[model samples]
Target: MVLPLELLQQFKASDFSDQQEYEAWRSRNLKVLEAGLLVHPLVPLDKSDNASQRLRQIIRGASEKPIETGKNSESMQVLRSAVMSLACRSPDRSASDFCHWADGFPLNLHLYQMLLETCFDASEDGSIIDEIDEVLELLKKTWVILGINQMLHNLCFTWVFFHRFVTTAQVDIDLLHAADNHMDEVAKDAKSTKDSVYSKILSSTLSSILGWAEKRLLAYHDTFNASNIEYMQSIVSLGVSAARILVEDISNEYRRRRREETDVARSRVDTYIRSSLRTAFAQVSSAELSD
Candidate 1:
């Protein structure tokens, strides 16, 4: 995991051709970091502990270095090693600790932007999707475990951005299912702390996502409606069912609070749902007319 000093120098000297190059580089390096876990076979407990500590040290050192070089560079490999090592040890680590450690490195919104680019890159094979999913899953688990309700907005936005790459109807449906699961977890966590503004905001965002998912389901149904597609219909049914459950959950939460602010949040949710539905319907209608 400790990149060679020579490699670090090269990374400092390296320049990306474009955003795509940087994204590809970042994605490849992350994969390398994840793959590094498999490099060492099962060993003695003492030896394993030592190796793990050494890996962490290397990762930490590399992360502190200034390296924006292209993919597979030494610095990238070292940083990836650190990220994966942290992820593997997440059961013992908290999200705040992880974020604090990462804050020392150049991994803020820039890393996420690079990740988003990788997700939207169609030229690559579908493996990138799995990578994106893994990262999101890790973040979601960390946020949930730490009870970081405020981070839900960013998490939700990440999910929404990822929706753009779900080209197929089945994938869209699957994404909705995944979103439903995440939202359910978030809602459960929120319910534990009723009458809190953070919880209310989280609830409002969840409602918006459910409403958006429903519209996407309808849009997918319209786009693929050559004839009676049973799977698509099933997906739509599942989405509707999930949306109803989420909406009801948020409604009950708002009613229980009965605060003016909660009422405003509820109104915003209604507006979001209506706007999303209208946009989805318009897109479908336009497509149909063009056809």
Candidate 2:
């Protein structure tokens, strides 16, 4: 809280291109404070608490008009006092020097995702950094504070890997395969936990993956040719793995049944192959008619 305010004070109007940019930057920091302290705090907030009220009032006013970030400014002092008062309060009323404003559920996930982005090479499109091993080790240090476990890390990494493949023109077969490999770990994590929040996140993440994979697989004849046929196997595997986890692990009805009886991946792949072949045939016939 004070750190952000301090940084704001350290920045001058000259540091930015114009007053508008400075105001925008100041507003973003204020929004971060509001989100961490009031919106999704690690300890559930008490609306009637004096410190919470004061912080909320300050944030609301600052939203309409940016507050002065000067160390000696009256509003800055009030804001700092309110933030510290709220941040210092523990759920059990214990006194502590440490604060946990940024460790809440979705907020923590978002912050961790930002940190994970550093694993990629900024200079080389779609490539991971050579220092990935070191960067990953350092990132692990924040796991305690971010409430991240292996499962969450695997899920986020898979998404990021897959996203890079897409954003960089999808030429990276290794990225696709790496993402598919991560799904194996994700599947294990899915089966081992039944936490409602974790399940919600798992469903959302896997659904995105499955949706993207199926979009390509369901019409593989159109999406892949000899030049990129290597992608088909990995994409199919990722889609099937995601589908199996969603059905057998997450869905209650499917959990009651056995995988041996349904064989989700095999059946799903069979469907994709047949559908793609049919589509390819239909297109050929239509083209002949047009000619």
Candidate 3:
């Protein structure tokens, strides 16, 4: 199965799970668990409350400091662990992880930065490949301890799980053309209709997908803080704005278009948005090692 049968049963739809069975879910899901090894983008559902818009206003307002941080805050630890965890993977995994993390872009950049440092560290004083493999093993351990399936699921309430993986150096690129292939298929269902927030997300997602190639070229710069940064911010803004329109705001514009029924359009939009975010983030970070 593309996804674990057990995992699919649990995540795809609601089901009965005894405590023990739930615990076992994490273990069986590993190895195949995409450890930030793939890339994609976000397009949150729309609501008439316009809450998404309001939230974006606040998020944008506080972009400089997403949350006020103590010298040592939970965010710091989360970022560090995320970065280190990603770094510890093998080079193939590392590249893919960077692409995966790109889904969140600079929003998750601080953690990404930490991964780059570790990548450099491994490059300098250790058995680069072996060391990374070891870290991946350790992460697997941590995943079990953390009840990774449950934790990650809660953390990612959305249906789409943003984990990417690239194990072999010679893996076929086309074999894993980052999803949204099913975006159209999924969108066609009643759930993804335009009046629905899901539909709005689909539309905006495809819209952003169109811009990723331009951003990939800009990754060569270290800071990329000048033009690239501004450009990315604009892209993120578009995503946020679209998400807001879809999830929180409902209007005649949405009903008038009858656009949600169109999956091909949505799939294209999903691809561009996610690819753009991934490429933009890839440039900002230094090096990343993977298992």
Candidate 4:
């Protein structure tokens, strides 16, 4: 979900600052934007007519504006408008509708607003390392939580091979970004906390789940050799059922911890997964009939 380098360069060029200062500022903001995207992938523009084009226009408009004061500029307004329109037009209209509606374009806009505030503070005091560190840590936690939920969704809704491919690709991208963006600092801070034990346990559990899912996915792919639709159905049913139980267990754990944000996120993801799985199964059934 990295923004295009050319667009980043164009945006940086519009800032009224020296090369070193602008580069530093751009790098920080880019990390925040990347964090935002990691938590919320962009929706496929094909899901809706012209929405992706509109989003690109809004982004390009931001690049053309004065970067220092562009938070409230006309470009920002248009960008907000585009987000609202896309959200409203999305097929999923639940309270957590935006979660399933598109990528984190709207969420990234919020990150930009946070960046604007940090920029304003930096202009006044010239020191915001503490604030920056705090924001980055929060983003890292959000990214991990969202990544887990997204993997769950993919397991339930997507074809086995496609799901495995995309999830593996995303994990690679996330590791690459973390390596590049000083995420080691965030890891260090987490390691220092008492919650580190719980975090490690959760991490272990998630890794095991993914490993199990990979084996199932591979088996499902092999079922194609015999043209055995029943075998394929059984595999998918087992996978989806296991995913639902796992999701429920995690949701209950979040509830016990009183993590309202995680609860909400999980609920939204659960809704979408159930809906999507139903559609996927229906499609498979329809295809069998057509055969």
True-structure lDDT of candidate 4: 0.41
Task: Indicate the residue-level lDDT of 158 in model 2.
Answer: 89
lDDT of 3 by residue, 1-291 (tens): 123222433341123357445434433332222222121222222244243344334334433544322325554344334333433343343333332332333223222222322322322322124364565444445344333432232222111211221223212222122222322233234233433434444444434432332333223233245544543433333333333334333444545666665343344346656765676576445335331
Each candidate: RMSD to true structure?
A: 14.6, 7.5, 20.3, 15.8
Compared with the true structure, what per-residue lDDT tens digits does model 2 show for residues 1-291?
445656766775667888887886787677667777777677778767899998888888886766887667777889888888878777796756877665467877867776887898767888888899999999999999989998899998988898889889998888999899999999999888889998999899989988998899888888998898888889999899999999988998886877578888888999999999999999999999999
Alpha-carbon local distance difference test for all models: 0.45, 0.84, 0.34, 0.41
Question: How close is every model to the real structure, measured as TM-score?
Answer: 0.36, 0.69, 0.21, 0.25
Q: Cα deviation of 238 in candidate 3 (Å)?
A: 18
- Indicate the residue-level lDDT of 121 in model 2: 74
Q: Which candidate do you rate higher for TM-score, 1 or 4?
A: 1
Candidate 3 error regions (>4 Å): 1-172, 175-180, 190-195, 213-291
Query: Candidate 1, residue 8: CA error in Å?
Result: 19
Looking at model 1, residue 233 earns an lDDT score of 45
Residue 211 in model 2: shift from native, Å?
Answer: 0.5
**Model 2 local distance difference test score:** 0.84
- Using lDDT, give the best candidate's number: 2
- Superposed Cα deviation of residue 209, candidate 4 (Å): 26
Put the candidates in lDDT order, highest first.
2, 1, 4, 3
TM-score of 2: 0.69
Q: What TM-score does candidate 3 get on C-alpha atoms?
A: 0.21
Clashing pairs in 1: 25-71
Pick the winner on lDDT between candidates 1 and 2: 2
Task: Summarize candidate 1's per-residue lDDT along 116-175 as a digit string, tens digits.
Answer: 444433664222465666665655544443444344445444344435424433344344
